[model samples]
Target: MAFLGVALLGLLAGAAVMYVLYRPRFEELRRQAEAEAQRLRESAQAQSRELLVQAQAEALRVRNEAEADIKQARQALLKQEERIQQLEERLARSQEKVDRKLDDLERRERGISQRERQIERLHREAEELKHSQQAELERIAGLTTDEAREIVLKRVEATARDDAARLMRQIEQEAKDEAEKRAKKIISIAIQRLASEYVAELTVTTVPLPSEELKGRIIGREGRNIRAFEQITGVDIIVDDTPEAVTLSCHDPVRREVARLALTKLLKDGRIHPARIEEVVEKTRQEIETIMREEGERVVYEAGVQGLHPDLIRILGRLKYRTSYGQNVLQHSLECALLAGAMASELGANVQVAKTAALLHDIGKAVDHEVQGPHALIGADIARRLGRSPAIVHAIAAHHFEEEPQTVEAFIVAAADAMSGGRPGARRETLDLYIKRLEALETVATSFPGVQRAFAIQAGREVRVMVQPDAVDDLGSITLARNISRKIEESLQYPGQIRVTVIRETRAVDYAR
Candidate 1:
């Protein structure tokens, strides 16, 4: 028991010594822990304070932004309210103006009603007065009402008839003027399509021989070759002393051309027998017929004419070698066809009929030597025989006034013929004759009453007369123009119809100083 007590006491002493040694170290650790906790708390408090300050600043900024937005919204609302008030004021003003207009309209309506009532009263009074005046006139004239009415009716009828005649004359003059304008426009357009320099007459064809010795060979033995050539080709072969040339003359240009060509070939072949000459002449005649046929077709195509009989076409081809007054008949015919077509189109006439008639108008001249009548009449007969329309036949016949123009196309064909034949350089004429014609036209125009001056223009196609305005009124000018035109038709022998115009002009002049 004593030993146990001694051990216990040693244990207690050791514990007490251990506590004394570790208590200081434990207290030092507790102090360090407390210091770290305090340091942590201070840092946390500072961080929280800084966060609070930042939150306060953010709240201030938010509040300021919200207040500014509210201010802007209030300003916008105020502007809207001001605009609405302005609109209301404008609407009120408009309403006032509408009310005023309505009142003015009512006043005007009342005034109009008063004026209508006054007019009705005045009309009734005027009717009564007119009746009374008519009765008084009947009583004073010692006539019954019926007789007075009949006389008045006759006077009114006469006056109306006079007025109607005047109006008819005015309308006719206007129509004629319009027709003349349209005709001139169409003629001008047609003339622009062709610009022929001059017509060349073909009477004789001269064949050039290569050598002077060839002429003798052409004459052949004892003039036998020349005689055979003349008999076969129907042309006179003139073996002149001229160097290296021979002339072939014939009234028939086609025969003359064939003779010339045959003679040329004979000389080239160096064969001067009657058999060779016959063969060459026959071949050349065939070639010429072929050429004429081709020329006819070409002319027909150019003129836009169709549906002609073959015989008519052949006859038409012969016009290529025919000429009148130094003008090629074929070219003149073509020009006439074109002019007629253009004028017919303008006048609303039959264009085909016009063109066909104009083209075939001179076809008779091709065989005029064989026919016994005028070329126009012969051409008309030929056209009639060739299944042409009566209108075409008439136009062809009337182109030279052999027959009176009975249709619009006939008149157009005549006018086209005149235009083609009357153009400058189309036919051979001396300058003196042209000047005399112009002077005659002027003289005819000046012979009219009230004409102060006269001028012949458009190559004697038109005569313009200047009349004294004081002497000739509008109606008098028309009468004067008719008189002048009639006088010209009676006195002048012009190729084409001359247009007589009377011009009455009034002028007012003022000077500024």
Candidate 2:
């Protein structure tokens, strides 16, 4: 059994020997395979790293390209915006030019259309007139148009005189009505605003004496007092013409007043000597100077004159001894100042300035007889000399209408002067017109075409013409009166115009009253 176990062990030992020899070869092969497997893993890791680097580089390049493209696009957009703005401005300018052209075209078209219509209307009217003339020519003696027109002209000319007279009368009446209405409004307004007396002065004045024997005292021994009185007063002392009175005849009112005072004093003192007359005259002169000062002071108080120069005050005093158109110069100036002040107050003018100018308006009258210039210029020079303002001097100069009024105050002074001086019967003319005034006025009224009878009424101040009612109506009476007035104004010269009145009476007398 031992021998058989030994043979099996030897066979197993031989097989183990063969396995150990092949184990070396197998180990070598395993080692080589492990080495190849490790190398392949390393190569794969390196290739993955290179591929990651290439992808990172490509992403960076793409990012830079996108930024450059965005910048170029912004530039292109800015250029397009500028081009659009330029196009819009050009369009706006073109629209403005078109609007201007359209406005001009519209105005031209309107004018052209009006001219075309006028031309067409005139052509149509001319055609109608030509046709009418042709028909008229044929009807009138079968003559040509020119011959017919000439005959018609001759016939029209024959009646033209009457037509012309009627047309002239109508035109004159229309113009006169308009002018009279305006004049009446002005005069009425002036008269209503001004308050003055209606007293009119006469050329002759009567001085009354206490007794008839006083007249003998007025005439000194050898009639020297009467002669001296006439020479000093420049008046005709009609002592013997009337009974128990004496008539003062002088054109100057100031001279007449002086003579009256002198005669009155001589009568009161019962003096019949020339030396006593001379002494009375000196006293009368002083009294007149005092009266003149009082008159000037009264006017200043009434006119509210302040801040006047001493020279101006003296000139104001001189105005008392002057006369204008037989009216007292101081009274006239006072009335003018009142009127001017009232008007200035109404018109919002400088009231104090206007009153001062008006009060001194007639200052030139005090020296006009001695001076050689117009009253207006002389008064202005006086005012300027008295330290008056240029405006006041201008107003004083323009009061007489000798110079044009540049201000409202000047116009007011002129208007007031006219209102006071232009009243009817305000002044009397010289040269003893008493010779034939009433007779001449009556004769002038009867010279009209339809005047039947004339009577001088209102103490020869107004003449009334009685016209036949059937022959002359109220309008014709007025026309006849105007004709008579024109003749009287031209032919017969008299003092303080004689008013001509025409009376056309249509009455049925029953004597019931």
Candidate 3:
């Protein structure tokens, strides 16, 4: 026990000594740890304070932005409310205006109803008054209403007939005098103003060769060159015993012209092969087309006609090569246009319409060989299809009397056509025969009964017969026309056909003075 006590004392003494020896060091370590902990706590406190400051700054910024947004929202709400209020006010005003309109309409409707009622009552009174007056007249006249009406009607009819006949005779005399003077003056003026020369064109064009040996070369090994030339040019090549000349025969003047040019070029170039022929022909075709276009442009400019379609101008150029009765068709058209313009200016008509119609009057002849119709109608259709005015189309259609000339311009165009085609040396028609035929037509028409006067117009194609109204009634006029036509058919051996037209006219005139 004593040893154990001694050991325990020693161990306790040793533990005490060790504790005393490490106490300062342990205190220094504890102080260092505490200082570090204090430093860490201070840093944590500083960090927390910084974080709190940043959070507060962010909160302030967010709050300011939110407040600004809320302010904008509030302003928008206020503006919207103000707009709504204004709209309400406008709607209220509109409602008031509509209400006033409704009231006005109601008043007008009531007034209209009253007026209708009053009108109905007035109509009834008027009917009664009319009936009473009619009865009183019948009683006083010692005749029924029917008998009085018939007598009055007969008297009026007789008086009107006498007045109408006198007026007709007077008006007809004045019209004839004025019309004859105007017609003679206009015709003379138009014919004097426009002078055109006639150019005769043959269907066949002769190409002169340099020598006979060249002809053999042109024949080109079994006539291949000639065959190629014919096929390309759409023209018939006539190589006969005509001295050193080859004839080009074609119905189409344009084709004939092209063939002539191509042959001339080939003869000049002295290259008589199929390939050379094709090249020469193509080059010649282009040259001819250019010439046609230039001619068309020149003629159109000369005629002072503008706004022609490209295709129309091209076709017009084609007319340069076409000939009608020894007259260049394009030249004839130009002359017609000038004459028509002069007449139209004198008569105060549409000069442009007249000139354009006259210019296009023979346009159908350009394509007449292709289209199957009268040239007048075909030309009219072409003009109409190409956006021409109705007056121009009508003038073209009426130029040949295919349709009746209705407008003054149409008549002017027809007159221009007649003047152009009937002038001396204009066509191949014998003037003596034309006059004789016209005289025969007039004689045949005037031989009919009740015929007061007979006039032959439209190149002896139509006879206008005027009948005495007293001698020939409407039905009698028809019969007279038929008889005259039959007599003309039986007596005269005319070409084509003759149109016999009978006219019976009535006129009523009154002098306000």
Candidate 4:
């Protein structure tokens, strides 16, 4: 600190001395500063000149390298251009060759088409030549060509007929040889499955009384009730000396049902007058109609038939109350259907067709009184009207053979109808009368040329004839039966139907004792 103080003192003293001595030294210091700035500028200029020289050399080297790469790239591009030019020339030549080939192919296609037409013409001419030759051959055969053709056809037909006859003969012989055993078995099968109780003429129907006095009431005031009842029911109300009961009667079922029900109500109300009787009958009529509709539908359903007319259905219902001979018609129809099915099964026929035909065979009986014609024919007409098939109509008409048996099914139906009515208990006859009848049948049958022993069965519905093996040939039975039948028809008056059976036996045996 003292040294700084002494220096400051000396500087003050020296400044006083310099201010007096070196006032002229300021110009010399300015000249020295100018000289140092000039030297720095000269050095900086020399460094810039060296940098410029190096940059120019580097730029020249880079330009030479770029020129060399450009020259190499130019050479490669020229080579690629030359190769593309060669490919273009080849493509032009190939296109020219393809155009020439296409022209040649078109010319060949035209020539081939012309040849195909020529071949077709040749084929047509060949076919015509062949046909002409055939015509010439046919003309040379005989008479005219048409006549020769007829002769050839006739020969073919004759040969066919002869072959068919031989076949039929063989079949007939074989069938006859097996007929007896097969017949027995088939008959047994038919009988075994048929279950029907015996039936008799049912002339009496019982109507229970409301009370003991109801019987008197049915007699009515002045017997008007009885008269009205009989007239309406078409039946004889036999109010006899019996107690609490009356016999209802009518041949027609609808009439009988009407009478029975009417009497029942009348007896219950204890009102015995014509007015009351009429009113009750009208009510009974409605009830019966309902029952009739239901019954008719049931019959059609069970018969497995459809599309029956309503009117026909009503008629069918009446059969429910109707009886033929003694068997109920409805029940008889079902029995017939069953028998027809069995027979059809045995015969290899349409069982449903047989059954339906048989069931409908007697449908006409329901309205026979109001219609005209044989029952079978009438039934056939009705069935046809109801849109049944022609086959069905034919079957129904021919069931009784009233019409010719056009089909095996028709004969089956007839057989079924007979089976239903003629079985024992299915119809009524006294034992003595039945026996006498059978005896007469046998007598008449035995009177035929090929004399035979006869036995009546099924209460004379059927007759069995065992002929002498020598007297009757295979066909003689049919002829003899026809003869017997003609005689029976003339000599005997029978009901329903009768079946004729001819039996022939041949046996080879040795007796041993």
Candidate 5:
């Protein structure tokens, strides 16, 4: 038993030694673990504090940006509000101007109404005064107002009639003066522009003999040759007293021309027998016909006329043998055509129509003996039958006043005819005939009631009549001149135109005291 006790006590001592060594080491390890946990907790708290501070700073920056944005928006709204206020002010001023214009219009309307009432009142007063004055005048004059008005109107009408008549006379005088001046200028220019030779052709043909003795041979042994010659040629062979000249006289110019040619040939050949005479005369007639045609064509060409009928040309050729008032009809016709054409150019008329009409104006004289009408009318008919235009035909007919000249061409033709016939030395008149024409002109002029003396001047182209001033007034003198002109036209058959002039003289004589 004693050995077991000692062994247990030794085991207990070893256990106590092990407990003291392990307890201090265990306390130290637990303190180290607690301190490491506290350090980890402090690190986590500091990190969280820094995160919170950063978040607050970020929130402050965001709020400042929002405030700045709100300030800009407010500034824009304020500027817009100012603009609206200005617009309102402008609208208010415009309304004020409109109100002023309306007020002015209303005032003008009121003033116009007042003026209209005043005018009505004044008009009534004026009408009353006029009626009172008219009544007083009627009472003083012892005549009705209508009677006074009629008297005044009659006087005024009489004065107006006198004034109208004077004005009409003055206008007539001025117009006549202007027309006369223009006519004179046109005629003078036309005459000055054209210079045509005036040849006075005789109807009678004269033949020159080599000797006076040849005349007896032409008479041919006891008048038998003469009679045969006359019978064959249809012309009178006059053995006149003239030296070395034999006269062939015939109304038919063609026959006269033929006789002239035959006589010439007979004298030249010295063969005066009847058979030779008939043969020579027949040959001469043929030659003359040929000459007539050639002459017709020559004139037509010279005058620049075309498209004439063959028959018409031949008839125109016959005019070469015809004479009018001692003027060759063909020459006169040519002159008329040239003058008419010149005048037509100057006056802006159809030159061809004028020339053609004027050239054919005397064509009727060719066959007047055969026809039963005036030469103008006959010529017109011939031209119409030849397919001439109406203007041409009318011009031909009216050249001699047979028909009233309708166109300017007709008047031109008439004027050309006058110019051709009226030129100096163009025609010859017997002294007896000329004297008779002058006397007839004077007689016609003096036949008027108030004519003191009448004088035929300008070779019967003009008549000057002197009128008594007391008997024929200025107006009366005009009437007398016209009447005298009409009488002369009716009585006289002279060539060209005649002018009538009437003169009235008013004399005032006074002696100085």
Candidate 6:
């Protein structure tokens, strides 16, 4: 029991010592924590004051900027109101000017109306005075108004008839003179400018041989080579006494050309056999065809014409081998084209159409052997088939008067053809045929009734018929001329044109007292 009491007292004493030591340390820690909390509170208060000051300054700046914006908007509105006021004032001034113009127009209209009424009154008074004067004149003339008018009209009729007749004669004379002068001038100019070579192509082509020995070679064994050449070329080979020359006679110019070429080549090669003749003839034919095409192109280029069909050009080239009355058809065509183009330019016609028509005028002669028609009509058909224009086709057809010339270009082409054909040395006719034509023309003219005498002048171009004055009056003479013309046209196949003239004159014989 004693030990237990002493142990308990020792434990209480240890506990009291521990409590005293820990209590001082706790007090020191608490004082430190309170001082830290106070310092943090003071820092927070200072930061809050600074934030409040920044906010106040920002609010003041924003208020000032907003007020400035409102002031600018008010100023802009005031300026817009001033502009509106100025526009309104301008509109008012314009309105005033318009009103003044309207008032002035109204005054002018009123004045015009008054003047019109005065003019009408004056017109009525003048009409009344004219009627009174007419009545007075009728009384003075001792005739009724209608009778006096009839007399005056009769006098006027006589005067007018004489004047009109005189004027008609003068106008007719002037027109005839002017037309003749112009025609002569154009024809002269055309002839003067165009100085083409006159070509006289014949149906016979003469081939000159190297020697008379060649003629015998050409006429081979049993004349078999000559027979073969003729059979192949459709040409007649005539070996005459003429030295070193053989004649190739064929109506077809192309065959004649081919025969001439073949003969010349055969003579050159010195191999005149039947087989060789046939071969050489064919090669010559192809060469001639090439030559024809080249000639056609040459003429087309020389004429400055374009867009001709290949087939048409080939046919035109064939004209180079053709001859009409001893005139080379191709040269004639070129000459006519040049003449027609010149006349067309002077007359304001289509120059290209005129030239093309003239160039192709004798195209039918190329194929006339195959086709059965007049050359002009056949050429027109060919042109139509080749897609030539209607104007060109018409000109081709009308060149020979087979068809009536409708356009100026057609007439120009016809005139050019006449000029080319009628010029001296352009063509030739046999002397016998020429005489027969002139005689036929005179006979036809004399055949008409009341024809006293007839003479063919101007190289048979014109027939002058003198009629008996008693049998044929002026009107009958005109009828006789027309009849003679119609008869000549129906019966005669003449070149160019023929003019028929009838003359009638009456003589009243009375001795002067």
Per-model TM-score, in order, reads: 0.54, 0.51, 0.52, 0.53, 0.65, 0.61
- lDDT for each residue of candidate 6 in 185-230, tens digit (9 for 90 to 100): 8888877777666767765588988889888888887899889999
Which runs of model 5 end up more than 4 angstroms from their true locations? 1-169, 181-193, 240-244, 486-496, 506-513
lDDT of each: 0.87, 0.78, 0.86, 0.79, 0.89, 0.89
Poorest stretch of ten by lDDT in candidate 5: 190-199
Q: Candidate 4 lDDT (Cα, whole model)?
A: 0.79
Worst 10 residues of 2 by lDDT: 195-204
Task: TM-score winner between 1 and 4, please give it.
Answer: 1
Worst 10 residues of 4 by lDDT: 195-204
Candidate 3 residue 283 C-alpha distance from true site, Å? 1.1
- lDDT of each residue in 309-413, candidate 4, tens digit only: 787788677777777767788778767777777778898998778877877888898878778889899999998998777888999998866788989889888
Q: Name the 10 consecutive residues with the lowest summed lDDT in model 1.
A: 195-204
Cα lDDT tens digits, model 2, 161-183, are 55665676688789989977875
- TM-score-superior candidate, 5 or 6: 5
Model 5 has an lDDT value of 0.89
Model 3: runs farther than 4 Å from truth? 1-178, 195-204, 429-513
**Which portions of model 1 show Cα errors greater than 4 Å?**
1-179, 192-204, 210-213, 240-244, 430-513
Best by TM-score: 5
Tens digits of lDDT, candidate 1, 407-476? 9998888888888777666776669988999999898888766889999998888989999999887767
lDDT of 3 by residue, 1-513 (tens): 999999999999999999999999999999999999999999999999999999999999999999999999999999999999999999999999999999999999999999999999999999999999999988898899889889999999978876776676568669969988988898888878776555655444888988988888878899899999999989999888988998889888988999998888888888889898898889888998998899888888988888888777788888888887667888888888898999999999999999999999999988988899999999999999998999999999998778989999999887777777666556665689789889989988888778999999878778999999999986566567768978997788554456778889988889997
Per-residue CA lDDT of model 5 for 134-167, tens digit only, reads 9898899998988998999999997876677678
